[model samples]
Target: MGYDEVARSVTERGELVLRRRTGTDGPAVLELRANGVFVMDTAEHSSEQALADAALASVEQPRRVLVGGLGLGFTLDRVLGDWRVEHCDVVEIEPALVEWMRDGTVPHGRQLLADRRARVIVADVATAVAEAGPASYDVVLLDVDNGPGQLVHDANAALYDVPFLHVVRRTLAPGGALVVWSAGPAPQLLADLEASFGHAEEQTHEVRLQERDEHYWLYVARPAAGRPEASAAG
Candidate 1:
């Protein structure tokens, strides 16, 4: 009942809206929706942090990283927090989301983008990954869609397929790693990852939300030639 529309935009892709809900305590939470479907919120984001943490831990020197899907900037912020990281490039397809984050519409967006080492590119992640130079990044983290299943945007499904994955693998450095965040179990994704990267590990995380505990999946993969063990992360 206390939800206030913060920002709204319409594009050929879909309609995106940002809303803020005020409660009795704490800050008002911001929620983002696309075409009437819930995308992400500022409330629960442990899985987002895990995505970055997992990828960063897997690589030996994760100085350069590419993060797909900026969401609420949690993953990028988490990646930048590590002193060892020198630069991070975030590729997001939605210009509205990027604008919202940069103009302070998304609250913490400005501070997160203020980091000198962080760069945000307004372009489709799939295209960006494909066009990237070989061995360009030490880590690649994708939080683009809801995973292979329950896809809010049908076009994002290509991200899970083999072709795009191969491109992602090509974009990784020698010891680089990739971590994808899925809203639920994507069993077939493991096989796809194994096929693309030659190794895949699935992590089912129990996300503690305000009202309930939700399970999210994180798929970790290293390039085929590499079989290094990823360091454990919380």
Candidate 2:
């Protein structure tokens, strides 16, 4: 009934650990780790849900969507609730995380994973996004790291860079949407998105997990339809 006696399990990675702490608040909460780094918990997934909701709202008729992270499958579950989303491809770098979901370590994960409309890809988000054909997805919701400024992995830093932003833009259909979930406000990343897509907006939401007004920023970028025409005088 207390956090001290919580059950713990060490996955094959050996770097990450999962803990389940029972309390009177609700169901048992799950916690994640990576080489002593605290990843996420199940107490509150507001940002994750918001990431999916914001992306779904921007699309006119989104049939296919790409979710860059599988944290607790909250985002995936929210996305699947939308009947308009016919196909959802989730890209998760950690195989253990995927296995945990399939094995029911994370509640509701098995349901979403078992859904015929869902496809779980065990690969880096960047690679998965690159392999996807241009204009292939109506929306892309990314939550791979804490944020651009506080990345879990160094390689993920490029995800917020210009080159990767272009890849995301190309992968989205005309007028398609891209939504990224950050642990906190990322002004530089928002600026990068604006410069790449010519249209971008940020939405801040409160996450009660930390209980200190945790901020999560959602970056929504809409791809342009056509290239600008050259000036006749030029």
The model with the greatest TM-score is: 1
RMSD of every candidate to native, in Å, equals 4.7, 4.3
lDDT of 1 by residue, 82-172 (tens): 9989999999988988999999988799999999999999999988887888889999999988888978789989889887888888788
| Residue pairs clashing, model 2 | none
Q: If scored against the real structure, what TM-score would every candidate get?
A: 0.93, 0.89
Q: Candidate 2 lDDT, tens digit per residue, 1-234?
A: 655322244544446567776764767777776656667888877777888899999989889999998878889999999999999999998887888899887776788799999999999899999899878899999998888978767778888888888888888877789998887789998898887887899998877764566677889998656744222122
Give candidate 2's error at residue 161 in angstroms: 0.2
Off by over 4 Å in 1: 226-234
- When summed lDDT is taken over every stretch of 10 residues in candidate 2, the lowest stretch is 225-234
lDDT scores of the candidates, listed in order? 0.87, 0.82
